[model samples]
Target: MPLHSLQRLSPTVLLGLWRLSETPADLWPLLPRAEAYRALLPATADGKRQAQWLGGRVLIHRLLAEAAPAVAAAVQVHNDPTGRPWLDGPGAELTVSLSHSGAWVAAILARGGRAGVDIEEIRDKAQRLASKFLAPAEWAAAQAACTTAAEASTHYTLLWSAKETLYKLAAQRGIIFKTQLLLGEFEPRAAGHIPATLVLSDFETRHCICYSQPSPGYVLTYCHESPA
Candidate 1:
């Protein structure tokens, strides 16, 4: 019930966010133990990890419960070999992704396709390491585009979070972030909304990524990918 935001992207696809104000003990009752997610509940999990795991389950339940009780009751979340969390059981009809950053956690559920979501705390790092995750051309573009250190940092965070979302969505092993996942460079837009694109396999695959400042000092992005 702590879902801070929910966007009905489509009839069966939903994007949900939880502020993580509840502790693991508080969330335990809401999230009943199930085989799919039971073992994932780490005994040593602190608040951050607890929210990271529980937020996804709670969001799925609350989002589905909104439409119908039966629809909401089918969610079972488990991880694949890639360690990406997925829904199972009655929830198998949906493809879902979950991410947690700082005090916020995000989950995206698509009725007919896969979804990926990521969030990052904004800080200055681009000036120090843009070249690490970005290509030479992208680094040059970022330098030419951003006018200040603060702007450059936001650019770095956006690029980092964008690739992370794409990687999670792809769930493909052995792909390097800096080289395999390709993203174009653009000025970091602080106001309104800015949309970015991420490409892989030399244009064989494409995904649209949208950025939003869900809270001060944090960046959030989510993408919907169709299975190839």
Candidate 2:
């Protein structure tokens, strides 16, 4: 299939029902060594990235196979110096990123430029780790958005997802989220646009990033020229 078909399907719709039944070992042969490294990560902090890598590849492979025939035989996958992955064969124009927490894996793919995605389960785990990545303003907004610690946890997870997506996008530009990335207020809106800010210190620039709550209890985000 052409890349356009895959682009037309909303990431929410694609990810909403997507599930993986096979293990990384089952799909590693179809991917290159570096690609396989991602899937082979053990279920530990040190291995989480590897898991994300593997999960993203499997998710992309399944989505592409369902979306286009051209993807099946020649969906060449490659990695940047930073270790971000990309498709580089017959359908090389497709850009994708994947993140998984627990049993669920989330992926985003689009033609041209770059795409990123992340998913998190709403729980206290997010709060425990909030201070590590979230800025003070983000914590304040999250606290104001939720009345209880549990709600605060969910809010933080959403913020983390947004920041992560932005981090992946920034990686394409050789930027890092820590120190280099900053976020603004959390606008409460659904579907259309929720206000947030992303500051890239290296470039000394800030961008108004749009966030979308595409599904109940979940946050989804992306960046690219309005889908052609």
Candidate 3:
């Protein structure tokens, strides 16, 4: 597939996805001018990291270009002290997050609101680590909902994604994930919003959130201010 022929999803809630049909090396010329310059340093690195970084950059630029062209010019990416990527530019009002696993990349972009996103590669080990991140009630509920190990694993991964999204949002306030972050049980109900809770730091807060199973094998949770 030619890179220019890549699939583009219709825009919704300030989010977009792009599939990179070209190898990392082939993408250099396709990136926006400023991104092409930053990608050059990654090329100097050993091949593995070079490919990883380049692929992420290309996906980010493509999604930003398609979703919010006016703010794309000021879409500067910077790393927090802990190395999480964030935007710091003229369009600082935009809240954006990106996640990728395997070949696909997903990005969430919000204007005048805070947003967070996470994508995990499903695996069995997720069950083993559940105790550390999940509240006791969450653990029991997840176990009861799943009859098979795979089902249980998927449920746990979704819970983890919720906590991760909370983590990123809390980072804005300099809160720690392990201690400050908390999540409630996963109540997958047919009516109304799915029930989940979050606590950022010692303060209990209510967040209006939404999520979707955008594709098979992955879950996406997004927390942001309700549209005004």
Candidate 4:
């Protein structure tokens, strides 16, 4: 479909979502440096992957339209050595994070710092793998708060999605999810903020990550960090 949702999370942060219904041909027209970005994709990429890839840029373009209309049609998405995305071209002052799951793609753009976004399709897998990502107490609290199997699935998926968003914001390699990046006490809701902490060797930083269920089976989480 078209741009699904776009919202200003803060004065300098914008979030956008796009559903993957269009083919690569359809999405290419929505981007500015379409041919250049296409060349950056792996030679082995299939049509679905290409579509998802372009869908993220398309979402970003839409977000820029809302936040920085002057450069919305000029800047292109580029990746650094670590595979983190940023804007390139005239007035390319924003950093971005892109993510796709199943048939949904999401992006976050921040003017003065880093941004991270994650969208996940709710499934039983998150519940099955919760122990590996959630702390012992976190898993227990989530399980106790869930009254039904479906509720547990949504809760676990949000935890994983929230941590993924935090990880993207960190941009530091070799961090473990269960111990280093942790979510504080909270039950899943249709939409709300979750308290989270990123534990470094000698210090820690906390964040209030925002999350929402854009559709029935999907959960979206995003956060932005200002430059230190």
Candidate 5:
């Protein structure tokens, strides 16, 4: 599939999602020449990994072309010490984040602030692994709030994706999701919005995060430093 979806979350922030339908041959011509993007692509030529990597760059290029030309031409997408993808170049001015799951790739582009985006398939692991990321109270609330098993599954994915999204945004060290990232008001749906809070360093400070479900099969969430 070509660019699956695009959203202007704010004047400075752009969100885009792409589902991979193109093979490695079709994507090679579009890949940026920068060596920085090399690691983003896997050694294996055929797989969701390569497709998602190409899809991410495609979305980044599309978003930049639509938003800013200078950023589009000179920008180099690279990873940080924490394995977080970011834009770096003389003309680069956007804070970016990328994620993929189950053949879907997601990207967030923002100016003047941080941005993080995550997409997770609504699989069965969330319910089983809830204890790894959620406190007892949060898990109880989520269970009570979900009306059905499907809803509960999505809720758990949302909870997991929400934290993953926040992790990309904060990009800090030694932050425990179970203890530091507290669950807030979550309105689960096939497609809807969610608000979350993150406590940093043993609850010394808290940051608010934003989330949304862009598609039915995946739970997508994003966060930034902006007030939005």
Candidate 6:
């Protein structure tokens, strides 16, 4: 029952967040195919990894219950070789993405298109590592846009989270986060929409990413691709 928030982003999209208050034992029974999912856990999996994995599936089912009631209990989560999670069985058509950071896990589902999401616990590490994932100009712009250190911290956290969401949407490997995924310059705030572009060798795609501080010390970002 640690479902922190589930919101209908639009008629076709549903977003949910789960704050971990339960252990693997508590969450095992909440999942649909409990044993199957349990088998997916690696031998090295620790308590936190188990919780994040279980919490993510539980959160997905919670969202599915609202978006596709009849299929909620039947849909299962599977991951590709690249570790991108997808829905199988009755609700196979729903494009979904899942992410976790610290004690928070998030999921986003799109009924007829693709969706991606990420959550991060705000900390100083993001600011220190900004240059690795963000372009030089992007980092400079971020510094110029924010007025205070806290805002700058939040800004960098969001930039990292936004790139993570974009990577999920791409659903492929060999992407260099710093060079390939490009986030447009923006001022930081409580919540807002920002632009991002993914540059491939032969082509590029633009995306609108939504970001917010859903809880204290945490930042969440998600993006969607319209169904064809």
Worst 10 residues of 6 by lDDT: 36-45
Query: What is each predicted model's overall lDDT from 0 to 1?
Result: 0.73, 0.57, 0.59, 0.86, 0.77, 0.88
Superior candidate under TM-score, 2 versus 4: 4
Query: Which candidate has the highest TM-score of all?
Result: 6
Deviating ranges (above 4 Å) for candidate 2: 1-17, 22-55, 66-68, 172-179, 187-193, 201-220
The TM-score, computed over Cα atoms with residue i paired to residue i, of candidate 6 is 0.93
Off by over 4 Å in 6: none
Q: Give the candidate number with the greatest lDDT.
A: 6
Clashes of 5: 0
Task: Please identify model 3 stretches exceeding 4 Å from their true place.
Answer: 1-13, 34-52, 66-68, 172-179, 187-194
Candidate 2 lDDT, tens digit per residue, 110-214? 654445566666567677877777777766777778887756766676667777777776664745454455776645555333344456544453444445543
| Residue pairs with backbone atoms closer than 3 Å in model 4 (clashes) | none
Instruction: State the local distance difference test value for candidate 6.
Output: 0.88
**TM-score preference between candidates 3 and 5, better one:** 5
Each candidate structure's TM-score, on Cα atoms with residue i matched to residue i, is 0.85, 0.67, 0.76, 0.92, 0.88, 0.93
Better candidate by TM-score, 3 or 4: 4
The 10 consecutive residues of candidate 3 with the worst lDDT sum are 1-10
At residue 129, give the lDDT of candidate 3.
89
Can you write out model 1's per-residue Cα lDDT over 110-185, one digit (the tens) per residue?
Answer: 7666678888888776457666777777677777877787777777788788888888777778777777767764
lDDT of 5 by residue, 87-192 (tens): 7785366778899888789998888777789999988799889989998888888878888788878889888988888778777888888977776765655555
Q: How much is the lDDT of residue 212 in candidate 2?
A: 53
lDDT of 5: 0.77
Please give, for residues 1-228, the per-residue lDDT of candidate 6 as tens digits: 579999988899999999998999999989887877767776787999888888999999999999999999988898888888888898997899999988899999998877899999988788899878989888888888878888878888889999999999888789999999999866567999889998988999999999999788999999998777
Kindly report which residue pairs in candidate 1 clash with one another: none
lDDT of 4 by residue, 109-221 (tens): 88887678999999989899988998998988988889998888888899999999999988888899999998898756799999999998999999888999888999999
